[model samples]
Target: MLKAGDKLPQFEGLNQDGETVRSEQLIGKKLVIFFYPQANTPTCTVEACNLSDNYSKLEKAGFQLLGISGDSVKKQKNFHSKFAFPYDLIADESHEILEKFGVWQEKTTFGKTYMGIVRTTFIFDEKGICERVIEKVTSKTAAEQILEA
Candidate 1:
C-alpha cells in the first residue's frame, strides 16, 4: 500500500454525481483519501459519517477529505446522499484506483482466501507527498485519527 513519502498517484474517476474528479484538482490542499471496502456497510458508514460530522474541524485544519470504494457510481451516489457526506466518493468499480494504491490484495476470511480491499487512509501534503497512512482505522473515531495523524 502507499505509505509516507510516496507521491499521490494521478487519478481520475466518476464521483457520486457522475462528474469526473481528478487528482490534479487537489494540488494545493492537504488531502485525506480513505479507501473503504465498500459503500453502506456498517463500518464503512460509521467512518464516513464520523468524517462528515467533523468536516468543519478537518477543513479548519487545512485538510480535504475523499472516500473511494470499488462500488458502482449509482451505489456511491446513494451512499453519499443517504448520509449527506460533505466529501466526494469515488466509484472505482474497475479497481483501477484501488490497485494503484496497492490496497487491493488477497485476504483470508473463514479459512478461505479471496481478493478484497483492506481499509486504509492516506494523508498527503499540499505538494502531493504522502505524509501518513492509517491502516488500522478506527471506524468511530476516524476523524480524530486523521487529525492526530
Candidate 2:
C-alpha cells in the first residue's frame, strides 16, 4: 500500500473526454486522486459534489484533482456534465489502476462478501511523492481532509 513520502506509481489513463492523462503531466502540481466504486451513486455523488464544491479552493492551493472509477466513459461524461466538475474523471474499467493503487479488495456487505474497489484517496505533492493516504473517507469531509493534508 502507498503511504506518505512514497513516490506514486506511474500511470496513464483516459479522462472523461477520452483525453490522455498521465503521471508525467502531473509533474509540478499537487494532485488529489480519489477512487470511488462507481458514478452517480449516493456516496460517490456526495464525494464528487463535495470535491466539486471546493474545487476552487483546491485549485487555489495548487492542487489538481482527479477521480477514478470502473465506470465507462459515457457514464462518467454524464456525471461530469450534470455536476459541472472542473477536474479529471478517469475511466478504469479494466481495474488496472485500482489494482495498481491497491484499492481493489474483498469487501463484505450485510453478510455477503465480494470483490470491489474501496473508496480511498491519495494526496501527492508536486514531486509525485504521496503526502497522505485516506483509508476511511467520508464523502462530505474528504475534500477538507485533503486540503488539510
Candidate 3:
C-alpha cells in the first residue's frame, strides 16, 4: 500500500458521470482518494454518506475527494445520485486504479477466500505526495477521521 511520502500513482478512469478523471489533473490539489469495496452496500453507504454530509467541511479544509469502487459506471452513477455526493466516484471496473493504489487484495470471509478491495483512504498533499493512509476505516466517523488526520 502507498505510504506517506509516496507519489500518487498515475491513473485515468471514468467518473460516475462518465466523464474522464486523471491523476495528472489533481496535481495542485489536496486530495482524498477513498477505496471502498462496493457501492451502496450498508457499510459503504454509511461511509460514503458520512463523507457526503461533511462535504463542506472537507472542501473548506482545501481537500478534494474521490470515492472509488469496482462497480460499473451505471452503478456508480446511481449511487452518486441516490445520495447526491459532492465528490466524484470513480468506476474502477477494471480494478486498475485499485491495484495501483494497492487497495486490492486477497481476503477470507466465512471461511472462503476471495480477491477484493480493502476499504482504505489515501490523503495527498497539493503536490501529490501521500500525507496519510487510513486502513481501518470507521464508516460513521469517516469524515472526522480524515479531518483529524
Clashing pairs in 1: none
**How far does residue 47 in candidate 2 sit from its true spot (Å)?**
0.6
For residues 1-93, could you state the per-residue lDDT of candidate 1 as single tens digits? 888999999999999999999999987999999999999999999999999999999999999999999999999999999999999999998
Best by lDDT: 3
State the RMSD for candidate 1. Answer: 0.6
Give the lDDT of residue 75 in candidate 3.
Answer: 98
Local accuracy of candidate 2 as per-residue lDDT tens digits, 1-149: 67889888888888899998888888788989999999999999999999999989889999999999999988989999999999989999998888889898999999999989999999998999998999999999888988886
TM for candidate 3 is 0.98
Q: Is candidate 1 or candidate 2 better by TM-score?
A: 1
lDDT of each: 0.95, 0.91, 0.96
TM per candidate comes to 0.98, 0.96, 0.98
lDDT of 2 at 84: 93
Better of 2 and 3 by TM-score: 3
Q: After superposition, how far is residue 18 of candidate 2 from its true place, in Å?
A: 1.0
Cα deviation in Å at residue 119, candidate 2? Answer: 0.5
- In each prediction, how many residue pairs overlap at the backbone (N, C-alpha, C within less than 3 A)? 0, 0, 0
